[model samples]
Target: EDGSAAWLRYAPLPHDSSHSSLPSSIITLNSTRGSPVYTAQQELRRGIQGIFGKTLNNGTSSNQHGAIIVGTAQAYQKSYGEFDDAKELEEDGYFLSSESNQVLIIGQNERGALYGSFDYLSRLAQGKLGAVSYVSNPHASIRWTNEWDNMDGSIERGYAGPSIFFENGFVTDNVTRVAEYARLLASIRINGMIVNNVNANATLLSPRNINGLGRLADAMRPYGVQLGISLNFASPQTFGGLSTFDPLDPAVDAWWANITNQIYARVPDMAGYLVKANSEGQPGPLTYNRTLAEGANMFARAAKPHGGIVMFRAFVYDNHINESNWKADRANAAVEFFQDLDGKFDDNVVVQIKYGPIDFQVREPVSPLFSTLRNTSTAIELQVTQEYLGQQTHLVYLAPLWKEILEFDMKADNRSSKVKDIISGERFRRPLGGSAGVVNVGTNTTWLGSHLSMSNLYAYGLLAWDPALGAEELLQDWIRLTFGHDKKVIETVTEMSMKSWPAYENYTGNLGIQTLTDILYTHFGPNPATMDNNGWGQWTRADKFSIGMDRTVKNGTGNAGQYPSEVAKVYESIETTPDNLLLWFHHVNYTHRLKSGKTVIQHFYDSHYEGAATAQDLVEQWNSLEGRIDVERFEHVLFRQKYQAGHALVWRDSINQFYYNLSEIKDEAGRVGNHPYRIEAEKMTLDGYRSYSVNPFHTASGAKAIV
Candidate 1:
């Protein structure tokens, strides 16, 4: 279990008995036989034993000294006459405070009590329990993580080890890990989780798999985490032996209803279904020429009877757009597909849209669909996996990227509307708005592939619970809890994490251009030449004279026109656009001057050099903390940092050389265009290069097969 505990390591306090102030006795007020409240009590005992090396008594008297009390508002009111102010909280909200001789943890309901227990334990773990007093409520109704895990035990974009939910071709027999996974999620107040990939397999609907899901739900029930599933859109036809999957077809509706009934009969508290349809060869309503809403409503109607909901992904876009059509932009597809269907979906259906219009690039404009669907509920989809950010090799803190998206002013409703407000249902006054993170945790002891990368997972849940939390402050708490309270360890980890994303963005892509990585293979490393003439709609369109897609409204793909008028106008004109997004909105010559007064090519050269140097510095800083943390984690992190430092040079050189050769532009510093990088300077593609040379871990044979 060297890396298994993650942030819940619960190491003993560093100071003497003076700093050890946590109570030794505990009393849970709830009398529910075997509910989530009982789970909370169990967690408190485990955390207490790990932290203080003491057993907590369950039936401590109220007059006893140094005892902790936990219960629902009604339970507390009936016992203590409502003096603790628990009744003022929302359903999942909790109140925590330390009184004279007793600590109080009260909640509005059972789930709330579970959250409060975790919060109290976290405070103790961080040594912040002395004067704790707060009423905490999540910003969204449902904070969920989609696993993208398959029944065969392989995760699609997973950098971690194999799946804990499955092995071979079905759910694992001994599901001890399932309960442990639920504990981690519950501690972060993440209410819901989908256990399968959105591109689901039809075989999961078999009676054997149905029973598998029931067992999975049972494992998660005690932790207060609701289990959901990702549905194969063509299941009616593929799994049910139906003739057609047409949404309006009576046979399809009956098939889905019957399946839903069977599932609920097994797992009574099943959450719902998540579907990715008509995108990337996934079967959807478009096959039958029906609207997306019609397809989503079909599933929603079936789940409504069981008090469930459906999360229909808005990630639909044709991957096979002809390369000849310059106006065919993937960034424009989501809004076009979903905008007309606003207010058309059933009340139980939520349109889940990705954070950006395009796939989860390092930087892109927020999806216009957030503002377009005024009458419908929308969830912002974020990628917690490091698919586009070095795949857990580099330490990239995603809170910075997520914060930019959450704080963006979309100008929705012609007013001050931020993405967070829109997704929280404040801007649209609709229910069912929240967030979903594409979580990539597997059976790896570190949870995520790298130990440092766990910060992204922690931040996703913390921010989804409350977007107002400071990214740096949260990182500090995580550092204290996970790595212990050594001052040097805290400072070193904080500095490394805070600067990670900017450094990554600097080396990979610049000026609002997406990460120039290989999309066809692993979605990893710098492959600038791979962008041109691709049918994936992820084109850079770099040629002899200019670079970037012309997405302007006047003479381009008109993707800028999808935004609100205020945002659209800014991106429509090069003179008014920000330097960061200059390329994203307009095609620019290599010499085009940015707001920073540097030519586009020069800025690219400087940023790449700067970023590469910063990556090396990160390795040095982490090396300085050699004896400060656990030796096992220290050595593992050092290996990753060393790998990142060396690989960053590959990214910097490959990208700089690709552009320099194309534009025939010399680097002002004269460092680029000097190295011979095994490239056919004429072809610009690395077709002859081996994958082992590109990334140390991959083989040429394996990479080509995927591509």
Candidate 2:
């Protein structure tokens, strides 16, 4: 009821449902107590007991007639016979067969067996008990979640609470929560996690902390989750008492090699290192006048001997931009930085590019870097923490948004170059590729601060494994497993979740203007002024008449040309660009007519009102299910819904008013600046509060003062 179990709740099925056909006994061919196969057996037993209310007998039975056999394909072959089905499985892949009285769960490896058990359990928990057989293989090899949890118990961009992995500048001594988190991740088929902030601390490389990481890894090892860490690029000089941390320097390379060896000594199956360097004040090879490839390869070489990969971030950009320059765009940074370095990286290094060229905006063209890095392994970076999309307070299902990016055809060499294919190492024909989700889960029992927000996390893992899955189908499965089989619950949650991304985009930022949030600090609420007039190149270019960033090759920053020729041609022209991203590709007058037949400013006004209205509707829909679900979860979600409804209004009014005051454009519907039902805060009788002028007054709906 507290939502600690998440989708793994395994709540009892309806009394009318039949359990007679379910397998009676569980058998594990590999009896290694601490292995993934053993974990699968334990999980199967737990799931069977919870769902059917019957504890099945464990151990190899002489009669395999009515038993579930779970093990690696090698083990199964040794026990029964060679499994032809194993050939179809890739790494961490499995086949689940319940075709007869006996159920066979075979995996390519021990981890695959564990994943198979979870998949089987998910189907059972969802009440899919009819005979079925299928081989499921992961779309990519590296499926990971990057936590931005700091060692001081604070999480950067994490909204839930303090860090569960660390406290007072060290990994936490107790890893009970870490193990629980690993279980939840394993259920969703997430194989790895980076437990520290990408803006890393050098102290994490300390001997004491390395030992602590071993403990954390041990706790998660049973669940088949490998551990990774974010490294501070200057760790050699800062933490190891070295003179230089230059990538080309032999001393620095030896320092990193030694430290990597030390880490592997403690945690043998370490997934890898994640590095965010030369961006936003982080130190990198750029500091030493070396290329990004050199920096990445240095770590890649160190981790290679231990079979670990280096996830070098492609979020590098100049923090300080001259706003007055029309051609300086941050959206061009990734391709500008990494395109020339295409075949230069070590095989074990994957360039982790954000889905967008900029930060995780509500809407962005799939980073052109996905197309440019053909010779280099690439993984799309997605944010599950909702840093820019209302930070989990609003129910924004990101699957649709991610699906759009994953399925977007970049037309690389005029071929079927989908983002998913490139990241899966299929189109590019690379060895290592996948996705890394920035899921800054904190201490909240709900895992992601809110109950509905967990759906995004659920869909993220499922999509990473298989990008072709429908967003709605994934949400429905999660709804059934987490909430229950209530038809209305499934229907209503789906409606709200499906509409959430668009609704959030409407109120916060429209027509690819980026989230008009306070970019300088807390990325919350509407602060259109903060978006412009700053060094950060996430600009709107709004003035007296025009709004948007002109990224066309002929006219502006040439960002539109970053895409492959075929894709670039579409974005390069205003007429060809989709209306949804019109602003991103061109700077237009407020009077410019959209493909929707509405003037630019008028569409802004209408969409804000429409989005806020939808937020209110979400509240009403949830209220309809008050009695259908538990009071604990119902009340918890209702509180967030109510807050979202109110905040959405602030977003709507502030954005509409800010643009109205700038462009002097009135809404065609006579809604902007006309709030007949509104009461001015300054008109109220003053108590402890006094009317004060709001600096950057557009943030307060163009109001002069507030009490």
Candidate 3:
């Protein structure tokens, strides 16, 4: 009820549902204690017992009627004689079948078998117990999550609580929560996890910590989750007492090789290293004037010997950007840095690119780097942590946003090059590619801070496995498993989740304006002034006459030119650009008419009020399910919805006020600057208080308030 179990709750079905058709017992071909097949057997037992309130006997042979046989295809063939369908399974692919009194779950590999078990349990938990059979294969080979957890028990952008993996600059001794986390990840088919923060501490490479990492890996290994770590690029000089940490330097390369060897000795199945270099002040090969590929391939060479693949982040950008320069765009940095280095990287190195050109904003065009780096491997990096999207205090399901990016047609060579196919290693024929989600789960029992937020995590896994799954369908599956099979709960949650991202984008930053958050410090609330007139390139550039970043190639930053020619043409021309992303690519006057037949300023005003009104409606919808849902989760979600409703109004008023003050335009509806129901603080009676002028007047109505 507290949501600690997440979607794996396995709550019993209605009493009227028949259990006779379900398998009566379980059997595993390979029962090695720590193996993935063994884990699948355990999960089957747990799920069956929880769902049916029945403890089926464990059988040794497939001859037993109503037996569920689970194991790798090799094991299945050894016991029951032949599984021709095994050839059809890719790495981590599973074939599941249930007919008559027998059910069989077979995998291409042991990990695949484990995935098959979870798939079966998902269907059973969703109350689909009739006859079902299917083959499920992941879209790509590398499905991982990057946790921004630091050594001091603090996650960089973490909202939930303290770190579960580390504390006081070392891995935690009690890894019970780590095991539980691996279980949740296993259910979602996430095979790897980078445990430390990308802004890493080199102390994790110490001998003692290496053993600690082994312990963490051991905890996750049974569930088939491999542990990876982020590396501080300067570890050789900073931590190992070397003369230089340059990638090409023989001593530095040897140091890294030794360290990688030590780590693999402890954790033979270590996933690999994640490096953020030469960007945001992180030290990299650029310090020694070496290429980013030289920096990445150094780690790839080290890890490649141990069957590991490096995930080098493509988020490199100059933090100190001069906003006055019309053509200096941060969005162009990724392609500028990596595009020319294509095919120079080692085979095991995968360039991890964010879904957008900029950071995880409310809306952005897909990163042009994906199409630019044709000869190199790639993976789309997504944020499940909701850094700029209300930080979990507001409801925002991001599956739709992710789907838009994944299914986007990059038109590489004017062909059907969807982002999904490109990352799956099928479009360009790369050996290693997939997706990485920045999922910073802390100590909160809900995994994420909020109960509803887990849906994003669930959907991330589903989409990584199969990008073609519909967002609403995935939401329904998660709802059924997490909340229940209640029709009203499913419908209401789907509506709320589907409406959430658009509603958020509308109130915060419509028409491709970035999330209008306080960018300098806390990335929360409205602070339009802080966005511009700063070193950070996240700018809106709203002045007295016009708004938006002009990223067109003709007159502004040539960011549009970074994309392939076909895709570039659409973004380059103002007439062809979609209204949703008009401001992102063009600088326009306040009175510029949109394709929607409204002036830019009017659209902003209307969208804010309408979006806020929609937020208020969300609270009403949740209230309708008060008695139907458990009081604990109901009140928890209600608290957030209520806060979101109030915050949406603040967002509306502040943004509208900022633009209205800047543009000096009257609202056609006369809603701006006219609070008819408002009572000034100076007009109200005060006790032990004095009137004070508000600083940054857009934060509130321009008035002297009683303090």
Please say which candidate is ahead in lDDT: 1 or 2: 2
lDDT of 1 at 419: 93
Error of 1 at 124 (Å): 1.1
- When superposed on Cα atoms, how far off is each prediction in RMSD? 4.1, 1.2, 1.3
| lDDT at residue 401 of model 3 (Cα atoms) | 98
Model 2: number of clashes?
0
Q: List, residue by residue over 190-224, the lDDT tens digit for candidate 2.
A: 99999999999999988899999999999999989
Clashing pairs in 1: none
lDDT of each: 0.86, 0.92, 0.92
Candidate 2 wrongly placed segments (more than 4 Å): 59-61, 686-696, 701-707
Give the per-residue lDDT digits (tens) of candidate 3, residues 233-292: 999999999989999999999999999999999999999999999888999999999999
Give the C-alpha lDDT of model 3.
0.92
TM-scores for the candidates = 0.95, 0.98, 0.98
Residue-level error in angstroms, candidate 1, position 696: 15
**Where does candidate 3 stray beyond 4 Å?**
680-683, 687-695, 703-707
Candidate 1 local lDDT, 1-707, one digit each (tens): 36788888778877763344567788888656557788888888888888777788765655547778887777877877757466569868988877555777788888888999999888888877577677988798879999989889999899988998887778777778888888889888998899998979877888988899889888998878888999998898887888899999999999999999999999888889999999998999999999999999999999999989899999999998876888889899998998889999999888999998889998888998998999899899999999989999988999989999999999965799999999998888988789999996888888888999988888999899998888998899889888999999999999999999989999999888899898776789888777767778888888878888889999999999998999999999999988888888889999998888899999999999898998999999998998887689999999999999988887887788777878889998888856454443334455664323234212121123122
